[model samples]
Target: MPTMKLGYLKVCVWLACVAIASVILYTVVMLSRRPLSLQTSRTAVFTGGHLRLWQPMDLHGIPLWDLLMLYMTQLDNPILKNATAQFNLTLPGTCGENFHAASQGLKNISSYPSHFQAFVLSMHFRDYSLLVGPADDEACPDGTQLLVAVKSQLVNFDRRQAIRETWGQKGLVRGVTVQTLFLLGKQGPGDGYPDLQALLQLERQKKRDLLLWDFQDTFYNRSLKDILFLRWLQGHCPSVEFVFLGDDDVFLRVDALVAYTGSLDAATQRGLFTGHVFQDTAPVHDSQHKYYVPESFYQGTYPPYVGGGGVLCSRAVATQLYKASCHLPLFPFNNIYLGICLRELGLVPQNHPGFRTFSAEAEGQEDLCAYKELILMDHRTPQDIIRLWRGLHDPALAC
Candidate 1:
């Protein structure tokens, strides 16, 4: 009897161990399967009529939730991501519809600037056709590696000439075949400008690199420039490897830009979007400010965006961005609008040390070594750009 009791007691102990193990496993499985609390204050914040997900670091130590969020980040509508990770729990649809609807209602407001008015009109009507452009075959010829498309003002002929004579010259640098083009919009007498079409035509005939569209060339219309250019790029330069889009006023270190792009790994090269990044910035409510954003127009912080002074991106990324832009409502600020499109693709703009969009401290502004180390710098005068380019190329100069 004692032997039999000992054997039964051992079996009971084994059964208890098995039950405990099963309970632990069940708890783990349930935790993993639990519905992600996207509604939680810690996970999401409603802004600009969209839910912005918490940064990945914010959710540290929560592996199961991270996994769930990562899955959501891969969804078709990708606006939920922050700077590092993406998570969208909202109903699947383009988030820009809300922005379009909101801006549509505000079109009748008399206080809005003409640029903002133009942007609102664009949301409903995208019929602004390309008045003049290069032949599709000639825009980005075969063997083109880098296409530098400068956003030039209709009046900045000197600036365009300076660029062509220096960094914007079309040729092979470090074996990278480079092509340069200028983007222009209409600026005729109706907008208080003399008819410079004859001069423009002469320049175009000589250079064969101007992409002109039939839209007003105003500050707010800059976003329209981006949209129109992307469409051109999609149709004309589809096979080009890389593109550098920037203001005409900026100076470029083409060799450095090429080297930097060449160093990117295959994955990064395929999705490269790097420059001076702006994050966590909000639109100003002050009407006097250049970047004023009325609450009725757009609400929330700007997404991570490269400064418009200079941005470098791969053709593939540019293509994807163009597609993403289609679903987004036009933002007055060109850089911020591109950033929104990046968010729509679940992409975060990578900040690089080379792109200095804003001018450095006054002391370093003319330093040759400082200029040599950067890929691009903004707010440079045409003469200054030419002088700097010559200085950098001088054999006697040592960094």
Candidate 2:
């Protein structure tokens, strides 16, 4: 009986050894299959030889499940790929010969006196006659206290209407004169609506707030829109004290912004270009991104730039930027192009606590006050804009 018991014990020990060995082999295989490059963050936790990782969030603050989705989708989604490829094909060659050889696309062939002149001349110099200008130019005049220029699409009539009702209403805000204008470019033939131009004309007659240009309104041509607006401003509305440049999708607290600007002394306001600024950001190398910059185009780090969702700049800075734009090549990214202009002018963008580019994810009712305090908030739909405007202005609601 003692011998049998000892033999059973031996068998149990052998089984335990085998089980431990199997676990070790399984762990090794799992580790070998795991992707090393996927660990973008250093905060990964390793447990039982398996890595648990965190991913960066999207613009909406949702966790990105796949890091390569942006790249993969470019290839997988045919419509998106075709659109992006068409834009890429239109991009002019970089300053280097290698890029010209590699891309074999549009080449810069102007033989100007200097590089600056070459850059300025290389841009498509088509003069797009304006379809509409400020209707009551004599009312606001050149000395308008604040001029708000909104970048808008041709079909965003609802958003433009929301603006007219809310903060964009042209009138006295806090004893300051505020004028708003919607800026747009011509719709391309592929936009599928032949009557868009006629509709725009009708809207212009009714509103008299549209500043339509004749350039093709593509996502990549946003910089052209900005520079052209600058040129127009220099000629048409030169004496405005401050200009609020923003997108139509943003919600602007015009009253708050006007009060803030009015509080500053005249000298302090002249040289200011303040917003939510990005510093030490590098150009994206991933070809899948809309804002990607190949090494042949720009190899250096991007200069600090204010978020284009909204920015408040003095007339002085705008003038300087316009001059700089004349010399700098047209960059695909409008905000980054503005950064390049600022770099050329030796001006740095100031960060304002009130300018927020991120969505306000409120924690409670009290958090609504935070939205009231911000100068601008991005990613707001037309409905969201109207709702927020009403909520903030509600007399009974208190923080």
Candidate 3:
């Protein structure tokens, strides 16, 4: 009976050990499968000697846990697993098949004769009936010194107002003719903001500064906006001396910008495309990053291109770019795609320190004097832009 009792006790002990081991294994797996939170350091993944590739759309959308699992299973790299755990890095792979499929579609599109022309023509063309343009064609008649095309969202009335009241005001800047227009795309039913269309029309009636296209307004469709803008320019305002392509959020120093452009010789102005040029950058592979690019879409290195926040191109250069864009495949990154257009044109973007796309200084440490000198400063809120515009011209506050 004592022997029987001993045997039973051993069996119980063995079962308990198995249960404990199983619990430990389950706990580890559960932890591994958990997604990394937003609080995880982004810089650690990108900058800490760990190069990560990300898809632009998935970078912020996908969780790090899923990315790590994919890398562990596909790559079987224990080092990558450790790095993903340690730095919480997300890699690209989940949407690879989808991206490949889209790439194939693009390839099929390119297989046709005059594919680029056909693609451009397929974009629904809207006429001046819905446009709120210059009151008179003579207002921007031939020899207009500058035409500032501000890419704006349909719902951002405050931003458009601030721009109009501030640097985007129509008139002479430093004795040069400068006119501003807001570029917009149609807001579709899928956008879930049907009321915004009515408000947009009201704003258009009041401002008469809007340039609308029929394409769906979306972040991914910015390239379409750009192309449409080019086409509009070609059709309507081809004679403008120079074009300033900028975002609505950017603050432009109209006086300073005009002075700088006026100083450039006519020949130099014709071929000029200058801004904060990015060089030696690669497409991000992380699927969660907003700026991510898939290998299937782009396999080559990006050409040197200016930051899209603002770019100043001469009329001739703009025309050349528009022509070049027709032959190239549509790329999602508008600015980088512009670089490709410039590349095709055998031109290079000139980097200017005065175009501060990545902020002029560290946050909370902005130098007003430096800001005053820059032609373009990006990422400012509407109120901040107004304040900056006011301060730049404030006689009492000399920087």
lDDT tens digits, residue span 202-231, model 1: 987888889888777888878778878887
Tens-digit per-residue lDDT, 75-125, candidate 3: 333333343433232333322112211112232234333423243233222
Question: Which has the better lDDT: candidate 1, or candidate 2?
Answer: 1
Residue 150, candidate 3: Cα error in Å is 0.5
Error of 3 at 196 (Å): 1.5
- Predicted model with the maximum lDDT: 1
In terms of lDDT, the poorest run of 10 residues in model 3 is: 95-104
Best candidate, TM-score: 1
TM-score of each: 0.73, 0.68, 0.66
Model 2 C-alpha lDDT per residue in residues 1-399, reported as the tens digit of each score: 999999999999999999988866654443332112222333222445553322222312111211112222232333233433422333222211111111223233222223323333334343456766755574256457899999998888899999898889887788787889888987745866455767777887888888888766767677878888888887766558889988999999998899888888877798889899999888776766766554334444677898849889999999999986654456667888798789767789988989886645553333567787788888777887888878888898788
Flag the better candidate by TM-score, 2 or 3: 2
Better of 1 and 3 by lDDT: 1
Clashes of each: 0, 0, 15
